[model samples]
Every structure is written in structure tokens, then in C-alpha cells.
Target: MTSQRAPLEPLVPHPRAPVVPQASIIPPPPLPPPAPASGPAPPHVFGLEKSHLLKEALEKAGPVPSGREDVKRLLKLHKDRFRNDLQWILFCAELPSLIQEGPQCGLVALWMASTLLVPPDGVPLDRLLQVALERGYTAQGEMFSVADMGKLAQEVLGCHTELLCGGLGGPNRDYILQHIIAGHPLLVPYDEDFNHEPCQRRGHKAHWAVSAGVLLGVVAVPSLGYAEDPELAGLFHPVPSTPYQPPPLPEEGFSGAIYLLSKQGKSWHYQLWEYGQVQESNLQLTDFAPSRAMDGRAYVVPAGGVRSGLCGQALLLRQHDTSH
Candidate 1:
């Protein structure tokens, strides 16, 4: 055994080896330096202070009555054929009384209520205007001049005509209406002749026109649909009826204007306005391709021959191509 045995190997250990004693291997305890004290969390911040103020102001304003009971009774009294016409008359008659409170309070409620009462396919524009004027002016306690009244008539009629003829949507319809309302001064001719120069006028005629244009554009664009056919017949399906659901209302209220312009065909183009400015692209549309980056302000671009953009004053869609 002594002759066969090799030289014994040296027992070398690591330089940083732990010196273990013959004892139980218990784990070390965790260090407790500090405890977190509980307190109230920080307040949430919103970017738009002015918008908050506006919302607060609107909330302070009370509700506007739509004479729903009267409308229901009227509907019951009339046949289905005459219901639409009668409803318009009733609505118009009530508008003045509704708005007598003031534009900020009364007008807002009246508009919202009216919108809710009438479905997209409800009443005709002619009847709607007739009722609106009768109610709206009566509340104001003033008679529009013949010229002004004619202008209003033309505005309403023209919008209807366009819808029938050109198939214009809400924005186009509203734009035409606003222009008529603003263009027509007193029922008779006014000595000031504000209609001669609409841009220079101090009144809200121009503002209303611009605002209307914006709103109409927002509602009109055939977005949010997946139909293969260009005709928007099967675009929007009816929402399922539910007891918990409230009536349909315009999702985006009249904020400000948004302007949008984008290419259409090889030479054609389309322009859209919403909120308070012009929208440069219908991002909602399938064919649209957005080129401009979105800043805090509205977006605009050249389309066809139009130099389209928002100039704060209004969303301008000027014809730049003089070739035609």
C-alpha cells in the first residue's frame, strides 16, 4: 500500500473563503432602516384651465325645457303624415320662449334639447326653420325686417335645396344657413349696411357662420364606417336598445373650428372644417393619408388649387389655382 500510494495533493482554498464553524446554518436577518409614513396623494392636473372655467359656467346654467309633453300630445292628435310638420311648428314656437333667458344659457339648452328630440331622419328643414324662427324671435321680443326674414328663408330653403341637389352633409348645410343668417341684416334694410362688408362687422354674424361651417364639417364626413360601397347605406348600424342607455346626442359639442384638406382624385381635392378651425385630413376616412404633423393648433395643407389653412379669424379655403 505504501509503494502504490501517490504523493498527497495540497489542500488549497479560495482567498476569500468564509471561515465556517461547526454550527447550524441559520440565515442572516434583514435590516430595518426606516418605515414609510402615509399621507394624502397629490391632486390631479388638467391642461386646459379656460375649458374648465367654461364647463363650470355651463354647469351653473340651468336646463331648457323642450315641451316634451306638448309634443307628445300634438303627435297623438295628428296623423303620422302630419306629425313631422306639426312637430316642427311646435318646436319653432317654443324656441323663442326657450331662448328668452339669454344665448349662453337659453340658446345652448334649446339647441341641445332640439337636437335630441329630432332624429337624423325626423323633420324636413323647411318645417324646422319655420318653427325655429317663430319661437326664436318671439323669445327675443323683436320682429325681423322683411329683408332679414327673406334672408333667413333663403338660408333654410337653400340648405334644403343643396341637400336634395348636391347631397351636402351637416357642415355644408349649416355653412349655407349661417351665411344666409349673417348676410341678412334687419328684416328691412339697415342704415348701417353690415351685410355690405361681413368681415368688418362687429356683430357675431361672421362668428356664427364660421362656427356653423365647423360643426357641419364634423358631422358630415362619412367616417366610422367599414362599408365597401361608396354609398353610406350600411355604414352605421343602430345601437342596441338598453334601459340603462340615454338618448343619442352629438358626442363632440361645438368646441371651436378644425380645418382639414386632403387630395382626392388626380386633380380634385376636398376640404373640411370642424370645431373652430379647418381640418387638414380626414384621418377617419379610409382613403385619407395624413402628411402634416399635429401641433396644438389646427392642421391645413394645399388641396387642388386651394390654399387651405386656419388664420384664427376663420378657416380659409381659398382658391389658389387661377388656371381654370
Candidate 2:
């Protein structure tokens, strides 16, 4: 009986629940936009005024002091004379196109006059005049008659004899002649102008080489002896007609040179170089606009002297080390 009762109690039914689908509940948190990248702003492009300010700061900061007072004095004097002479040249260069001829001739004359007044250590005014006359006469196919050229020399010499007497004498004449020969034949005698035709027509190597040398002289003169291991004198020495070539560009170590050209209806523009490589800069004719071209307006970097950028509307020379 007990077994029967237990079986009846087991018959009770079990409760069941309905199934519900949950929605794809939460969407991914919206991805935050990628953070913007950040860096330092570009450096301010250098300008003339900025360059000047920087130069002044560097100068004020001081450099390795040159030891000799006399050397400093000589350099100062040389710089002053160079500035003055270059100014005179640039001033003469500004006349009407018709008188453009005057400046080059004027430079030649001035060089002669300066030589007469302050002949360098070994050169004499008379001898320099003689050499120039000989070259001029030779170009004309006429025998050099010192009398003719001497007249001009005499006038200059007479006017500046005291100055010319300074170093005018022996080996300096030959030395200067060597340099003149090395220089470009920018001024050819009217008769020898035809000789240059070959160069103009065929692109003569001699012509370009000489031109380069002359340009070197022009650019290097102001900076000579201002730096260590000066090569201005060597640069001015005429290249031999043989196979000898100048030292490799890098080896030559040309610090750099500045060239200024004034365009018609435009401002002055400059070209810069270092070890024969041109440097790119934003400065151009528009940068120096409206000012007429002047001779002494150039800023030269001395052979090994340290300086960055040039200043002055006309001509000014200030010594500052740029080797930093």
C-alpha cells in the first residue's frame, strides 16, 4: 500500500518559461577621431635685416682676437680704401648707358692712379704704366711708345706721386703684370677686338678662363689677407698657357663670392657661391629694388674670415669672424 501512494505523488506536472531574443544591445563606442599630429613650427626665413641683426649679435659676442695692433690697423685702412675706391667705381657706373664705357675705363684709370699713390709693396707706378701701355700698344699693332701712355701716367703720377711712392718700385710691377695677364681681357684694344672674335664665335676656353680669373680678382681683392692662408695673390696670377689647370674646386676651397646685377626696370639681384656650388636664396632683384646700381655696394667675404650676409646701401666694410 505504501509503494502505491508514493507512485501517485510523482505524477505532479513541471512549469515551463517562454524564450525571448535580446536585441544586439550596445553598439561599439564611437571611435574617437584620430588625434591631430603636432610638431615645431618652421624656422623664420632669413632676410637682409635679420641677417644684419644676427651679424651684429655675433660680432658683439666676440671672436678669437687678432693679436697684432698694427695688423688690425693695416686691415682697417685697407678696408676703408677698398670701400672708398669701390664706391667711386659704382658711382661712375650709374651714368646713362651711353657712358657705361666710362666706368670700366675709369676703374682702369683709378687702379693706375691708386697704384701711383699707394703702390703695393713691390710695384712702382711708372712700371705698371709701362706694362699697361705695352699691352695697349701691342693690341694696336704699334710699338709701345712710352711717351704717349707716359703722358697719362705722368699726369696721374704727378698728381699722386707721394701716394704712388709708397711701395712702387721693382718686383711689384712684374707681380701686378702677372696678375693682369691672368685677369680677363674685358677691355681689348680696338684692333685686338677681332682676336676675341674667335672666342665669341667658337667659345674659346682661354677667354672664359681669363674671365674667371678676372672675376676672381674682382671678388677676392676686398677679402685678401683677411683670413688665414689668403690666396688672392695666387688667384690673380695669370694661368699658364700650358696644360696646367687650377686646383680642384673643393681643394681650392673658395669661401664664396657675391655678384650683383641690376636689371632694367628691376632691382638688384645677387648670386652666391661656395666651393663652386651655387647657394639658393629667396633674395633677388625685387629685394633691392628702386636703388640704382652703385660700385661700392658689394659685400665681400674675406678669404678665411667669418661673416654671413652683407650690409650697407653703398659700400661698407666691417670685420667680423663667421667661423662659428
Per TM-score, the best of the predicted structures is 2
TM-score of every candidate relative to the true structure: 0.17, 0.18
Candidate 2's error at 66, in angstroms? 26
Candidate 1 per-residue lDDT over residues 1-324, each given as its tens digit:
011111211222212211122222222122223334567431111111324553354345433222333333323453242312111111011221111111122122222222222422222322433443343321221111111222223333232111111112244334433332222111111111132211322221111121111111123323332122132221121122322211122333433222211111111111122322221111111111122122122211212111111111111111122111
lDDT of 2 by residue, 156-260 (tens): 333211101111113322222222223211111110113221111111111110111111223233332222223222222222344332221111222322121
Worst 10 residues of 1 by lDDT: 184-193
Cα error, residue 123 of model 2, in Å, equals 21
Highest lDDT scorer:
1
CA-lDDT, candidates in order:
0.22, 0.21
